[model samples]
Each structure stands twice: as structure tokens, then as C-alpha cells.
Target: MSPDRSQTAYAASAADLAVRALDALRGIGGTAMVAEHVERAEDPKAALAAIRVVGADTFAPYLLADAVFHPQDAAAVTQSFALFPPPVSTPDPPPAGAAEPWLVAWRDWAMAALLARLAEAEPDGVRAPRPTGAPVLTDPDHSQVSDAPAGQGSDSHAAHGDGLPTPDSGAPDDSGPRDTDWQRWSVRMGQLSPLALPGLDGPVHSAARAAPLALARGATRAVLRRDFPTAARITRWLALLGAEGVALPLDPVPLLAHLRLHGGGPRLALDVAIARRLLGLETV
Candidate 1:
């Protein structure tokens, strides 16, 4: 089949697989059975194939995360990279009003996490360098030198010098802080930036020690704006961080459920639940 047709087919199969996984969770067999089924459902290659079929769609990263966390298996983690291959170069920013931009961001963060896990598991394997050096912001319109009054843009640039540029950079500066904020948050989480994956030729443990308050602030703003998809996506990242022992400024579970209920669809809902469970949060 063609690429598009294959993606459509994988989406359908993944949806069915998610439904079965959810049912297994809800069934009398409980978590152990769910784990068994998740393992038995596909081997490494097949699972990777299914994940690739979905591409960067909303549920793909979540499925990969589930495979990484629940199975606690190296093969699952290794296969995830097939879907989230190494960045060839700095990626262009997401298009204006792109459908599910959050998913794209999530894929990058998820890959970074997977690489970190792999490095930890196998010290001799590939390892990524920790994010060091000043962040390099490259905006075509905004010169590397800030136009803002001295000390004003200092913190903005210092805090997220590596942030992805907003599509609406041409808009009035005050027009949409939320959009701008989300872009920076995505970059800080190593979304589009050049934070190389671990197990490649860099330092291990390179994730930023981002302030919890900043993450909470952006998530709250996304929630207030009724941008649940963005909120949910960010919350998912926070949960991933939390799984790695990072403390969060706030509990993202409630907001995650809210998004899952509002309109996240079955696949997204399953993804949210899986993320919560991985984080030791209640998933009811």
C-alpha cells in the first residue's frame, strides 16, 4: 500500500489495539493481563511497524511510551527510535494552525527520554550530550541581538534561547503570548531544538533542569485558553519527566483527564491514561 494508505490502515489497527488494551485494563484480568497482552500483541519489529504506520499522530508517542515504560524492555525502547529517528538537522517550526502540533513536539521529547533510558541501560551504547552552552535563537525577523530594552529581553533569551520561533512572529508582540509561550516550552523540553538524543555522541543526562513553575504556568495558560490539546500534550511531557523522578509544580492528572474527556478521542484518551499510569497517578 501507499504511505497514506498504510498510515490510515495502521491508524485503524492502532485504534483497535488501543481499544483492546483499554479493555484489557478494564477487564477482570487486570494490569498483569494487560501487560501480557501488550507484550504478546506484537514483537519488536511488528510494534515498530505499527508505530511507524501512525507516524507522529496524537497516539503514536503515547504508544511508544507505554511500550517503553510498561514492558521495561530494551527492545521496545530501541524500536521507538524507528518512529522517532535521529534529527537530520534543525527542523523548521510547525506551520501556523498546524493540526496536532503538540504531537510533533511530544515525539521529540519522547525520543529524548527513550535515548536517556537506553544510555542508562547500556553505558557502552550511544549517549547524547547534556544540553549545555548558551541557547541559540535563530529568527529571520528578530536579529540575534534583541530589539527589546536591555535587561528586558535578557531573561527571555536567557531562559529559552533555544526556543522554536513562532509562526506569528510577524503578529504584534502582544497579540498571542500563549502561542509564543507554548513554542518556548516545547523547545525547553527539547522538542525542535538541537538537544541531541542520548546514545549518539553526546553527554548523557542532557535534559534541562527546567523550572516546574514555568511548566505549570504554560500548562495553566493553555487550559485557561481552552487549548486542551496543547495542555494535554504538555501535561504528558510533565508526566514523562515525573516518571524520571522530576518533581512537577502541579498535578497534571486532572487537566489530562479534562482534555481526554473534552475531545481527545479514544486513542488520545488511552494515551493520557497510559501516561498517568506510568507516572503512578490514578487512571480512573
Candidate 2:
């Protein structure tokens, strides 16, 4: 397969594997059943299917697949698909507080376990720190950046301990186009035609299409290479819109609701917030 086609195919395959694995776990029924499944499987697929039959079919397998193919959200490592909260027994309260304790605990445990496994699997420490989304990126808005003259924030960024530029800093470029990766990336960004994602129109669609090129450039230039915050943001959005083959939402509420339905975390939450803020949806 051509590179892009191959990527698309691989994504479809991974998703298929994830769904099948979850199905298997559902078949198993409960914690004990999942453990038994794990004991029997040699490969991840078998392991996932085994886990699927269990009642708490962890989203770990699908989340892992997402990370392998997309690798944008560090949170994905711990994201679980296994346990769906049982229906609320009592009538609805006037106001809800937080997610149920068991659900939250399950998510945390899954995330933490995945993080530990990732650390064990990759000893080189070459990857960027997976984001916990505690402290936000705190960069000025992308629109603000784009609105500024080409050279704005091109320099004067705070240096990291290792001296790599921070997220807000445009990719390291010299005094001219040769000085930075962004310039080259910008050119590629300009060259890319907007993809016809579902429901996308006007500015939002335009921004979504252009955003990936900027992210792609960042990935290629070793700017937060393994850190997939931006890419994940884009992918999750694409998945939702593409799934229905509908236009992307003009408003953020639909998007936020969609994320909640799909399962959400710090990264997806942050993306929803950012996208809302950027599009002026928060003001509405």
C-alpha cells in the first residue's frame, strides 16, 4: 500500500482488532474471567479478546492501539474501555458532581498501569513526557500567533532545561526560512489541500486541515516528537466527524458531547476547551 493508504488501512485494522478484543472481554464476563483470558493469550489480540469476555473489558487494548497508530495522547496508555458504569439506581439528582468513584478509579488504575508498562517497554527515554494536562500549555492563542507578523514569537521563547524550544516557541528557525522548521512546515501546510472531513465548513474546517500540517511539521522536526498532544487533538476530532460522515460541528457543544460519549480525558478535554475558546464558542 502507498504510505497514506497503508496508514489508513492499518488504522482500520487496529480499530477492528480493538472492537473484537472488547467483544471477547464482554464475552468473558468479570475480573476473574479477564485474568483467565490474559493467562491464555500469547499475542495482544488474543490477550485483548480474552479480556473482552470479562465484565470489566478494559479499553486498554483499543487505547493501546490508538497510541500505537496515533501516539498523541500519553493518557491513552491508561485509557480503559472495559467497564461501563451501571445505570444509576436512584432518580436523577438536582445536580451531579463528578463521575462515579469506581469509574474514576478504574480509569486511573488503567492509565497508571499503562504508563508503567510504557516505561518498562522503552528504556531509552527518547519519548516526550506524556501529558497529564495538569498545567496547561499556556501558549497564546494560535489565531493570535497567526495574526501576528510571520516573525512574531519566532524568537524570545523560554528555553527548556535541555534547551529545546517550548511548545509556544515556533520550531527553531534561523534568521530566515533556513533558521527554522516552521518555515518549511508552513510551506507544506500551505501546499496541503483541506481534507473533506464530515460536517466541516468555513473557518473551522480550514483550521482543522491546516492544524495537522503544523503538527506534522512539529513531529518531523523533533519538536516534541513523541508528544502527540496536538495530533491527538486532531485525530479524535477527525474520528468523530468521519464516523458519521457528517459535517464537523460549527459549535463546540456537539463536539464536547461527542467526546464524552467516546470517552474523554485530560487531552481530549483540553482540546475541546481550546477548540471552543478559539472558535469563540465559549462566548456563545
Off by over 4 Å in 2: 1-19, 22-33, 43-135, 139-284
User: In model 1, what lDDT does residue 246 have?
Assistant: 78
Winner by TM-score: 1
Question: Among these predicted structures, which one has the highest lDDT?
Answer: 1
Expressed as tens digits, the lDDT of each residue in 65-148 for candidate 1 is 342234343344445454445444333332322212333433444444444453355322222222222222323344341211
Give a tens-digit lDDT track for model 2, residues 94-135: 112221222223223333344345444522222222111111
Score each candidate by Cα lDDT: 0.42, 0.31
Scored by Cα lDDT, where does model 1 land? Answer: 0.42
Error of 1 at 191 (Å): 6.0
Residue 111 shift from truth in candidate 2, angstroms: 4.3
